[model samples]
Target chain A: MTVNATILSKPQVKNAGKLLAVLAAAALLFAAFLLANGADPLAIYSNMISSTLFTPYGIGEVLIKSTPLILIAVGTCISAKAGLVNVGGEGQFAIGALFSTAAGLSIGDSLPSFMGIVVMMLAGVFGGAIWSGVAGILKIRANMNETLTTLIMNYIAYQIVSYFVFNDLKDPDSFNWPQTAKIAHSLRLPRIAGKINLGILIALAAAVIVWLLVRKTKWGYSLRIVGGNANAALHAGINVEMVQIVAMLLSGALAGLAGAIEIAGVEERLRQTTGVNYGYLGFLAAWMAWNDPAVAVLTAAVIGFLSVSGNVLEISSGLPSSAISILMAIVLFAILWKGKGRKSE
Target chain B: MILESLLAGAVQSGTSVLLTVCGETVSERAGVINLGTEGCMAVGALFAYIVCAETGQPFLAIPVACIAGGLMGLLHAYFVISRKANQLATGLTLMFLGLGLTAFLGRNYVSVSTEGFTKLRIPFLADIPIIGDALFDQDPITYLSYLICAGMCLLLYKTRFGLILRATGEDENVVYAYGADPIRMRYLSVIMGGMLSALGGAQLSIAYTHTWIEGMTGSRGVIGVALVCIAAWNPAKAFIGAYIFGAAQALQMILQQQGLEISSFLLMMIPYVLVLIALFAASIKKNGKMPAELKKVFEAV
Candidate 1:
């Protein structure tokens, strides 16, 4: 008789248990924070929990936030698995959003409504892929540190976006501060089921695509083999450089898609702060999940929940928004510390 | 006349960026990527502004900021190296922590009336020529940066401790074979690097603006990271990398002042363009020097 492997996988069980305990400790810290502020800890907690799910808009907002996070993290896992650190996810994401916005604004009068949206989304993906591929190419050809190259590329992306938004793309007739013309609704990503947008659906589907690429396909197998052991994979004739470059390009494209989805689904135009920190959050999620693609979705949702809950607490308790960031740091440290429980040789 | 003024601004950028590069060079030498340099700089600027704003002792601001910055570094090292957390995550966290903490705490410290550090020159050198005045006639931080560069050269090459630290960066496990503790050496290296980075951050607030602003570190922190790559793990070369970036940044600011001529955004793209070329070069050199085993083998996420 075939038996379940529950008894055999002892270490995985223990790791899970240990992590659960650490998370419980963090929850206790959250309770303490509420008490220290002289507010009703239970009430705020209940309120945040209720607000997130009880209201339709709150649920929608969480999905909206989760959409981009999922896209970015999945892409992050791809590059990370290929043994490349693509910290330029932020830059790639921004460029995707920027190019998408540019496509929308420039072709505002030219294309049919449905076609414009498709065009914009494609532009974003290509823009992000190429942007990230530059670093990937450098790593392959020049032996550059992808980490440094990607990190530096972020500033270039930021500056160019800043220029486009503030100078060239500025809506001259608009009476408001520095911002672009609102992207036509025709170009926005449509919402599905009147709640979750097409973006979330796209992100979920993309994850499946990536999972297949990394697990089922021959190229995916080669990339993973190389990532697991570069020298060994190289000897086996899996062009390590080719795998890395392809993985990075794919990763960057996904990251860019995430940005485009954010624009299409939520904020229709790009802003300077057009969600930079989301990249960091995605980075965190990917890391916490140990680069596991499926787990990234859950981690992104958890981060979204914490942030949404933190916002509720901030408004009701008069605590600074930064307190949430502090809690995030605590939670992050707790997860990482917990990960170190009972190291193996 | 504007050209000379622009040239002078360029000099300022070189010196200021130098402060950060010198700090990063030391950290990378120990094989730790101190991504918190921007945050440390921001914290330093914030405290420098706050300390000076209080007690009317503007002069004490730099030292105070440096110490506070060192403490922040201590916190970073405690979490990342001590707890064995991922370096990139720790650095990013430090960045967010510094960004939020500085903004929240130093909101009130921004617009206070204060006299800042005045630019001083090496007396004889200041009189000699245009280049000399541009380079030598600057605030004390620039001079301090020069000393730091020289000091880095001596410490990394000449001293026994330097050799040990370098050896530690290459392979802590091997270094562990020796009597010295890798942990302690890392703590010391990271902390010192933090202090120096804070000084670099404080220099902008104290010497340049004479006041602190939230998010003042701008691209400087990221620039510091890029400098290590361009320098190819040599402190001396890192110094050169810093100046090149400084020139790019300074040129951008000058061009903006000159009416955004030549596309100031293009100017903004300067460091990035240089870095792209540098990365291409670095990637070509297959056996480029990366610390034997970066303190943390995996950046954890």
Candidate 2:
């Protein structure tokens, strides 16, 4: 048992050490940035760490913020595995929220909470799938670059949401505010702790399920084969286009599910600003984890901590909350620089 | 009257995208796509604003902005060429870095007023009818952009350097085998791309808006990237593509001014939607004009 433990622990330890080293380098670089800007890095770092991890409220906020990130990162992993880069998570999330909000408004208190939640989830999934489906089809049929197309679609989606919320779905009682009506209480996701709802659990379950699907399923094998080389997969009788399209749909569906949960589990209404930049932040998390679904969970949490502490940095150091973005980018750069030659693609 | 202004607006606003697309076209032609164009532009705008505010010289701000942008490109090149990082991911990181760093550093410059470029109207051309006014009467930078387009066209097609650059884009190994330093060529191209992108941002802040605002570049960098495809990786075609986008922006403004009852949000989406349609159209036609090595960066078709 001892001999077996050493074999398993060795690689895990080495990987952990590398991660720590990279993180230290990034932290040092970011500290210099802070110093250059006339802020004291040591005080800001301590304030951020203590306020974020040492307080229960802060921990809850971190978990809450990470719920959508975990969902989106796991979804990104699926598309990344299929050799598809789905940068449309922001658009997918918006469309998903739009769909689920419409459903929640109509089904309010008409069905049991359990049944209503399931329907919203499905609605979110369908919305997200359709959103990414266009980009996938364009890639397959039109030979359009998915990266640029999806990004373009993101702006269009935001406008679509704005058109709806500011007109058709505008809350009548809110004096022209661009937001949908709040859903019935029964439709909201039940909370497990202080303001921390079941969204985190759903996000976690989705991660585990995706990890299993990618590692253990036949479809996953085919997806990986296609990702490795489309021409080779085609020659080997794999339906490469169909596999990639499905992967794109699944990826978008997960992002949409995050939107649905944000509406049902947290926001309770759709707003124009709902889930803004969450997609890119989640994409960053996924990339940081090297597109591993399991690792995305931890990375999402780390990002969540940074985001929550952004407020603390602002309060303690007189720096803008956006300063945290610089640190996050530095961390990603360090990982990208140090993680060279690990994967050929 | 609206048509005249629309054409004139296209020339005015399109200059920024034109400069950026030209730069990106050259980079993509050299077998590297700098997604950090937006980041470079952001940094350029901020630095340009700072320089104009401090030194009171809009002209001096241009070179300062270019240097800042080139440094950003250098960082991207080091990661992509030396460390072999994923181009798209590194570019996005660079984007966030530029945006975040600018936002952090630009706190003081927000809403700060600065002296900017004065418009220059060509003497006789400005007196002509619609076409002359729309085409010839504008900022000095706008006139410079016309020259830039022509210069870039000549550099890409009429020069030996252009041949080597295009060859590098097609296949770096082939260029290497022919005894050319492909890596150095890529570095130069990417740096040039970054500098030009910053120049566009400088035009935007110093010549166009004449004030500092966070994220003022506003997806123009990404729009420039998208236009490269429609341009077929050619600098001349990029001018036409960029003006079309500019025309869309002008249309949005015109419609809004007319109080056309259409939601401004819908109109705001025109440029993006148009890009999507153009991309689809271009792809379906299968012009097959993309750089060979750049083709590997996108999904295999």
Best candidate according to TM-score: 2
Span of 10 residues, lowest total lDDT, candidate 2 chain A: A336-345
Model 2: per-residue Cα lDDT over B195-230, one tens digit each: 989999888888877877778888889889999998
lDDT of 1 by residue, A1-345 (tens): 224575447886887788899988887786786677577877887888788868887787777788878888889889888888888888999999998888888887578877988888898899899889999987777767778788888888888888887888877766755667888877777777656679988888998888888879999888777767788998998889889999999889988888888777788888888877787788878777667778888888878777777788788777777777767766776786665555311
Tens digit per residue, CA lDDT, model 1, B192-273:
8888888887778877778767788886877787777667666777667676777677777867876755666667788778
Those runs of model 2 whose alpha carbons end farther than 4 Å from true positions after fitting are A1-15, B299-301
Give the clashing residue pairs of candidate 2, or none: none
Candidate 2, position A63, lDDT? 96
The lDDT of model 1 is 0.78
Error in Å for residue A139 of model 1: 1.0
> What TM value does the first chain of each candidate achieve?
0.92, 0.93
* Candidate 1 positional error at B98, Å: 1.4
List model 2 lDDT by residue over A11-115, tens digit each: 667866787898899999989988997989999899889888998888889999999999999999888888888888999999999999989999999999999
